[model samples]
Target: MPRLKKTVFFAALITFATLLSIFCKMENRSNAELVKTDFDQQLASFQDAIEKKLLKAVLQRNEKEIKQSFLQTRAKYKRLEYYIEYFFPSTSALLNGAPIDEIELGENLIEQPTGFQVMEGIIYEQPTKENRAELLNEVKKMQLNLQRMSRFNEQYQITDAQLFDAMRLEIFRITSLGITGFDTPDALQSIPETASALRGIADVIAIYEPASTDKTVSSAIAYLDKQPNFNNFDRLTFITDYLDPISKYISSLRLARKIPTVASGSALHDDAISMFQTNAFNVDKFVGNSTQFINNDKVALGKALFNDAVLSNGANRSCTSCHHQSLAFTDGLSKATGISKGEPLLRNTPTLTYAGLQRGFFYDLKAGTLEDQALDVVHQKQEMNGSLTQAAAKINSSKTYFSLFQKAYEDKSGKADAWKIQHALASYIRSLAPFNSRFDRYMRGDKKQLNADEKKGFNLFMGKAKCGSCHFAPLFNGTQAPLFSKSEAEVLGVPSTTDTIKPKIDQDLGRYALYAYPQYKYSFKTSTLRNIKKTAPYMHNGVYKNLTQVMDFYNRGGGIGLGIPVENQTLSADRLNLSKLEIEQIIAFLGTLDDLP
Candidate 1:
């Protein structure tokens, strides 16, 4: 109880705490080192398999053996995918990303994709000498990428938080990409590969917590090991029953161990346990700046600003001129009408519902943030023809607007700036994402929210219909899942009209207008299918008036299948062969995505 004795006791306690912190760090490093060793071994095995089995099989013209060896090599690659993707993402892309020409907006360079997706397409095709040589070259390039990953891994320090985060993301990858055949489009080996991916996560988990029981993981892996046909994989059941539970389990384990959640900004909330949950995504993470955050005051201010024609210069048009919240924030028109009477805007008025979730805005994917999007629309001649600078001045003149601005921000200058105005409007738009649609309810365990036909339609959309492959679920948009880092654009070869016999490709340059990339010609950012029932007149150009007509276009294989010339169509030209009944069912499922008023 004496002062000296108390000081000595406290000093001992502090020393013990410091030692404990050091021990935890050491343990984390040990686990990470073990994971890295496993990853390096897997990479080496993949390279060896490619060199010893796959290339030789191709050289010998043994089709069966080549496929088998390729599968084995991919299994190895899948095992280390978590770290490779999390730590060295660029290298990971070169090794197994989508086979497309991705444009780096910042660098203004188109990166030619070369990875597993590319190799899968080539290897699955006829083993011609040209194809064989191309595959070999791609394989060699991937090997070099693997070597580069090895170099990076040696210097990389994997934190416990990052390890758990990466593991959870892999589950999302399996559900959204692996099982959907986004990468293995040609081979349809997604089912088996999914099992491999789950096993890989389970293995990593075991290294950290050997006593951990992965019941959901085991169940999911077992289900996938059955290797059902890709077309009839019962993805709805797999996702709701198996994959979702696995993600929760991993998150629970992470929390139980008191490991930190991911600290960096992501489309997903740092502490979200399930991607399907309502609070999974954080719109704030998608903002252009910290100033563009949402609050009750900001939302209310934005709502008033959104409906005010004062921002439209002398055009007398407001955001509500094109977006009506009663109709899921979309104008009920084929194409948006401009300030000029009877003149249509270039693109359809996309719904503001869940607009905050995407990385890109507009049909052409021009703007990077909602704030940027607000600025663009205000300046566009046909849309608003207003300047944010002038609009800010007008807002400052209004006493009502002054009070709203005072409530929303700390600035008492009584002068509205362009960026602040943009941020307030963007914040209001950001608050629009309410993931409480019927489909969302059903996914979250209110089973009665969806009927039998609706359930079947969801399965078809995710599987046979191949809709999920493009419209990644939960958001049902092109925002890439798990990472939720970027939005995707697809060239669907949409026709100018509904006329099937004499179809003509829509002449809209789309994203090509922004970058002039050949692959971007006619490419548009994939719009969210949420609230499709309410937001009618679909597509960027609003080509389809109804969901049935939209289904028919996709059913017949988009514009290319409609006999329209489309060399760069990203959509498959193969007929979906969906029966009329199946189309109805799919439409029913889409109806479930509508949010309750």
Candidate 2:
């Protein structure tokens, strides 16, 4: 009788535990549903506001009304940016992408950008009938795009993991793109938009942790609201004291909620505490999956091969001949010297510092991988003029190389092979990305590393100077942040020489040689400005002798402002109107980017 009573009691206890588990799961599901429903409603409201206010203002030629309506629409769009950008990026591009021509590389198709940026360019200009017609067309497109986005929200289900992931990325976007005035070049309304973006994230946070108030996010929003001026905004303080802390808080909240991070194969790792942290990026994501596992053995082998003259045709020159480690892996020459005496290479030798972080390798962005780049250089007549397969045979004959290969591959019969050589060399390049520059240290809480001038320079670079728009923070490279999937090429209309008058464009066709696309003309891959202090004679053609000349060129608005006839100049032609002192300050900031040895 006692046993029977015990069995009944135990069974009842088990049943109660299971019911509690189900209830907890159901509650979590309900939270996700609630968040999604709120987002959907917000998106619908944003679309309606645009259709009624912005579209009407454009039609009536009311400039004042148009600007006001656009600003309101921008705030609403920012609220939905996190989900829309993550879930429906293609649609998001149509609604609010950069006002540039996006070319589908393989398909050879051009996608003309149409969105808020396009509308801003038109509205900020004279309110002519032709401009109104163009603005009207973009407004109608946005209306349809928003409608299509609404349909996706209705059908698509959201998960707790995705919601958290999207929010974190949005935080990154605000720091990298939003505050930098990347999307609001003409409008300059990024500060308020950033506040709206934070509010959206705050709303979702409230749903998950209702009892806990996010003081960090609230503080940031308050600061932004109080000082909304673009030029006077303290971006450095905002990033360090507020945005970074808010991101960390969100990460902590997600952890406390026991939400799993979605496995997104982005350059920015999911486990990164802050975007400015050393381990924030995953260099492996930039390479092929097969070669991602880089060990010390591979790096050692690569280092040796990089210095050995045996890899060259006549066993005379190696990579170090052009790429000097003391000079940030760059030769202090206007152009790289060829293997044959007096025969120079077509382009300048770019620094190999942090080279592996990019999707594209060369100036023209013709090579997809570092391994491919290594192979190309080895086979090029002007460079190495040595076959990797042949080089492998040479290495195989050497007993020293045989042992190194055996240990690297963990195979008894391991021999030097072409693919292994390429991987090893690429591995060495990847290991070069040591995120330990003075600027990096400053960003990671070492406040004393940067002085007042450097700080102001950083603000200018990120804000008024428009340098951060291309040279993104953390990496300071062309790889767009929050995604870091693609490398951008810009047509700067680089002159052949430093001639202020009659500035003739460099004859090099750049990417146009590879694709023949009109848009690709004069387009060179945006190189990393991390070690800009050491890598002198800037530009693909090595046109500028010093950073001062480069600054002057940009200040005057690139080649076009110098009277160069460039129809497809990607750089803004309008003068930066920077004072000499401001230019000096920017240079001082660039000096801080040199990596620590």
Q: Judged by TM-score, which candidate is best?
A: 2
In candidate 1, position 292 carries an lDDT of 63
- Candidate 1 lDDT over residue span 1-597, tens digit each: 999999999999999999999888767667767777777787778778878987788778788897898888887788777777788888888988888888777898888889888988888777788988888888788778877777877887777888888888887787777788777777878888888888889888888888865577888888877756888788888988998888888888888888888774357888877777878887778875566667898898888999899899794889998899899999999899887898998989999988988888999988888888999999988888899988887888899999888888866865678987788888888888888888888888998998889988998898788898999987899998877889999999998988888988888999888787789899999999999999998999888889999999999988889998888989989899999999999999999999886
Candidate 2 CA-lDDT value: 0.89
**Clashing pairs for predicted structure model 2, backbone only:** none
Estimate, for each residue in 354-409, the C-alpha lDDT of model 2 and write its tens digit.
89889898999999999999999999999999989888988888888888888887
* lDDT of model 2 at position 437: 87
| lDDT score of residue 341 within candidate 1 | 93
For each candidate in the order shown, give its overall lDDT on alpha carbons.
0.85, 0.89
Candidate 1: residue 351 lDDT (0-100): 97
